[model samples]
Target: MRKEETVDYHIKVVWHAISRMYNQGGAMKGITASSGFVLLNIDQDEGTPATKIAPLLGMESRSLTRMLKTMEETGLIYRERDTEDKRSVRIYLTEAGKKQRDFSRKAVIFFNDKVREAVSPKKLEAFFDVMTTIDNVIEENKNLDQKIQLIENE
Candidate 1:
C-alpha cells in the first residue's frame, strides 16, 4: 500500500530521473529529450510519415505538430509533401538532426551497457518481461479503471 512499493511510483521515478539526465545532456546541443526522440524515430534515408511519428512516440498529433514546427524552424528537420498525395507529409532529419539523433542513440546505448554491466542478463530479461506485461495490461484496458468500473457496476 505504500507509495514506494507501488509499481507505477518506481517506474515514474526512474523515468523522471532518466528524463532529467537526457534533458541536461540534450540542452547543451540545443535539443530536448522529446525532440531527440522524434529525430531518432525518423527514418534516416527514406524519411518517415508525419502521421506515424506521433504513434511511435505515444504522443498526440497536436503536441507533435507544435514540436515539429519548432524543430523545422531550428533547421533540425524538414517536411516534404508526398508526390502523389498532397495531404500526406513525410519528415526527414536535417544534418543537424542526424547528429543529435546519433548522440541520443549513443546515450541510450551507454545507459543500457552500464545496466548490463551491473545486472545479469537473466535478471534483465525478467525485468523486461514484467515491463512488457504491465504495458500489455494497460494497453488492453485491463488496468485500474476497469477494476473501478467493475466495482461500481457491482
Candidate 2:
C-alpha cells in the first residue's frame, strides 16, 4: 500500500497540520504549540504538581524541565515546595502565564467551534470513537513484540 493510503500516515499528516496551526497561533503570544499545551494542562485553581505536568501533557520529563525553566525565566511560572510533601514541587502560573493560558484557551475553543460547525455531530462522534479504538488497540499490543516470536524449523 502507498504511504499516503496508510492510516498512520494520514493521522501523522493531520496532526502535523494541526500542530503547525497551533504553533502559528501560539507564536503571536510568544509561545509554541507545546508550551501552550503544557500551560493548558496546568490547573488554574490550585497549582499542579511538577511531576504530574509531564504526564498531563504527554511530554518527557526532561523536556518538561526545560520548558518549565524557560517559563520560569520568562516570569510565566513559579515553583513552590509542596506543603504536604516536602520533596515534591508544585508549579503555579504567574500573572503573565494566566494571561497566556487564557489566550491559549480561547484559541483552542475557536478552533473547536469552527470544526464543530463544519463537521456533523455524528461524524465527530465517530471520529472520536475511531481514535479511542486506535489508542486501545495500540495499548493492548504494546507487549506483543516482546511476547511473540515466529520462526521456521530448519
Candidate 3:
C-alpha cells in the first residue's frame, strides 16, 4: 500500500502539522511545544505527582527530567516532597507557570473550537471511536512483531 494511504502516515502528518502550529504559539510565549505541553499537564491547585506527569503526557522520563530542570531554573515550577510518601515528589506551578499554562489552555481551546466549527460532531465522534479501536487493537497485539516473524519463518 502507498504510504499516504496508511493510517499511521495520516496520523503522523496531522500530528506534525499540529505540533508546528503549537510550537509557533508557544514560541511567542517564550516556551517550546514540549514545555507548553508539560505546563498544561500540571495541575493548578493540588499539584501533580512528578512521576504521574510523564505517563499522563506520554513523555519519556529523561526528556521530562530535562524540561523540569529548565522549568525549575526559570522559576516556572517548584517541587515538593510528598508528605505521605517521603521518596515521592509533587510539582507545582509558579505564578509564571500559571500564566503560561493559561496561554496553553487558551491555545488548545481555540484550536479545538475551530476544529469543532469545521467538522461535524458526528464525524468527530466517529473519528474518536476509530482511534479507540485502533488503540485497543495495538494493545491486544503487543507481540505482533514476534508473531509476524514466526509466520514469515514458517
lDDT of each: 0.93, 0.90, 0.93
Best by TM-score: 3
Instruction: Write candidate 2's Cα lDDT for 1-154 as tens digits.
Output: 9998888998999989989999998887898888888889888878999999997776799999999999999888899999999999999999999999999999999999999999999999999999999989878888756555532322
- The true-versus-predicted C-alpha distance at residue 96 of model 1, in Å, is 1.1
lDDT of 3: 0.93
Per-model TM-score on C-alpha atoms: 0.90, 0.89, 0.91
Q: Which residue pairs of candidate 3 clash?
A: none
Model 2, stretches more than 4 Å misplaced?
Answer: 144-154
Q: What's the CA error at residue 42 for candidate 3, in Å?
A: 1.1
Candidate 1 wrongly placed segments (more than 4 Å): 142-154
